[model samples]
Target chain A: MKHLTTKDLMTAGIFSALYFLAIGLVTFICMFTLPVLGNFLLPAVAALTTGSIYFLLLKQVPKFGAITIFSLVMGTFLLLSGHFPLAIIANLGFSGLADWFTYRTTFQTKHKSLLGYILFSYGLTGPLLPLWFMKQQYIDNLTSRGKTATYISGMFQYVTPTFFILLMFFILIGAILGGIYGQKLVAKHFGQTSSKQISDLYD
Target chain B: MINIQIKCLLLFITHIFLFIPFHPVQQTVLVGLLLSILFLEKERKRSLLYGSIYLVLLGILIALPYFKSFLGHSFGQLAMVFLLLYPCFLAGSLLIRTSLLSDWILLLKKCRLPMYLILPITVMFRFIPHFKEDFKHTFRLQKMRVPHSSLFKRLERTLIVLLHAAIQSSQELTMAALAKGINQLETRPVSKLTSLTFLDYLVATSSLGLIVWRSFL
Candidate 1:
């Protein structure tokens, strides 16, 4: 396996920042505009928006550790921004899996990389894990904010098991749509240069 | 006064405090304390901005029950979250504004972190600002082209252009770093002073004290 050069690392940093910012902007907008629904919309919207950035990163640096490094940076950022530590663990786990799926693959067979992207998209769910596992903490937070008991209950009413499963399903669908869209956009816009680069790498 | 490590420690401590549930008043006090630290660092503008934002959000949160509407509740919930995250935000702002990238690099190197982690972090700090500029330029260029284009088409084109720009910029940055012999550098000399002073110890001790008191309460 070819090691990541300084150039590759630098590219990773650029795209990772782009990817992080894209997701954050989309989520922030969704949060203010849609409120509770934003939580549901987050996974799908992020997947759709950031898919192109992820696909571009893969095409640019089809190396072993790039995705993992991206995940590490994101996880550390989330951790620093006051998320539960478990979120970071989940994020790293999914991204490591993503890295494995695309390991040593050429861009010609990019579906594996698409699968990797889907797994990467699933990492968005990590930050929300505490809402289920640590409900009381959230409840206490809501209560301490002087939210009425009904408001607190109403907030969590959507967090049913069925909704959780549906969320996973939506994530999968979103990833599929986003991944395909990203591949198409990348092929249309960045295809020529990246293909030449990939050919050079493999040849 | 404080070193980069101490600043990072304060950030970590503050974020951890955010995770644990606390009274709204207590959280406000903690955020205020962190904001005062920002003021001590001479970040008056940002401190004032954050302080006002906190106050506004607090006002909305307190007035939420009176409105008794979905939108009000939504805003209330959002306000509560922002209020909760205020300290972390303040700490992050303090850290980013007060410290230099070279200082971070020096501290990371001093701790003997791996090269992989160090390089990307440095590049990330540098490129975030660069990407913002790139996005603005790309959006303007998109606006200048095909004024009659559909919104979706224009957005799609803009994202494509931005990706291409990101690639070009990353290539240029990598070349620049290579030209600077970044890989060969043993230690980068920080332009700014980073020595720990009495203030560092005082802040560190107080941060620890706050954490302990909060946790035990």
Candidate 2:
């Protein structure tokens, strides 16, 4: 595989920053809105937020390792941000999967990029792993601490295995929608920018 | 002087410690460390910002027992929300805020990283400031376009110009780095990691001990 240049790598960094910023925004909004909507809708919103950055990055530089690098950086930061290893590892793994999609095949067009983005979206479920794997342990931890039975059972709406499965499905739908939205923005805005840059270079 | 390799290792190990299962005591230790680091940095403005965050998180964690009655099921959830990020919040922020890209590359070299990985990271680091400059130009040109009261139109134009400018700069940046023969170097200069300091030893020992404790103890 051809190596990435300084600019290509920098672009990835910038996009990585931008992508995580979107994630922060999505997470914040979800947290505030949690009172209105249950925690169930979070995976979907989180998935959609990833779309803009993936689309823009793919459109600008569809290089082989871009997605992988972005994913690694993002996962690293997420772990640093106090996320669990299970989810962070899952994010990297899914991102690796997304990288395979682009690297194994050409990623020059919207459709190819969208496919990669969709695969990458599966990683958004990383945040949900705590609920998935720790449901029993978490409940036990709370219960042993003297939390009431009613309180522990009340969490069923969100922490149940069924809800977790549905959350993944919702995440998939949100990611697909995000991909479409990002592609549309690219077609509208970025298509105009490509030619403009050539003119700027000449001047 | 402390070694970049150690710094990188410490940073990574610290992050892993944040992930230890059944780790409340360690998390509390990390939170204390984070607060100390922030205060040591002494950026007055950021002090309030990060300080408030830690305080709020501390409050939530402390209030867990008291709030459990009212917050009910959500109390556990909310307490968890705070608990999860308690350890790494300061560490991640400090690492990103404190280190430069060159520092990371130097550490990578010290670790004997491949040129393929090194080349991109160096460039990615260079990209942020360069893009920031490019965006400023786009914003300026956008302002010129909105000579009158056409604020909305100007905003749209500015955004378009910004995207064009971003794409253009990225291409230019690639060409420049490539032309500099970033990838052609056969070997990187060997890095000498000097002695670890007291603070470094403390971090290393504590993190190592914590890992062992979390894993097997």
- What are the fnat scores of the candidates, in the order listed? 0.45, 0.24
Q: Which stretches of candidate 2 lie over 4 Å from their true place?
A: A1-7, A28-43, A46-52, A80-83, A102-112, A136-157, A192-203, B1-26, B43-52, B62-72, B111-116, B122-162, B179-194, B206-217
lDDT score, candidate 1, position A184? 86
TM-score of each: 0.86, 0.74
Q: Return the lDDT, model 2, position B199.
A: 74
The superposed Cα distance between candidate 1 and the true structure at residue A65, in angstroms, equals 1.5
Clashing pairs in 1: none
**What share of the reference contacts is kept in model 1?**
0.45
Chain B alone vs. reference chain B, TM-score for every model: 0.84, 0.68
- Please write out the lDDT profile of model 2 over residues A79-112, one tens digit for every residue: 5444555677887788888888876876675566
Error of 2 at A193 (Å): 8.5
Question: Tens digits of per-residue lDDT for model 2 on B30-127?
Answer: 56655665556554466467767766755765555454343454655755654564555556556555665656666556667566556555554555
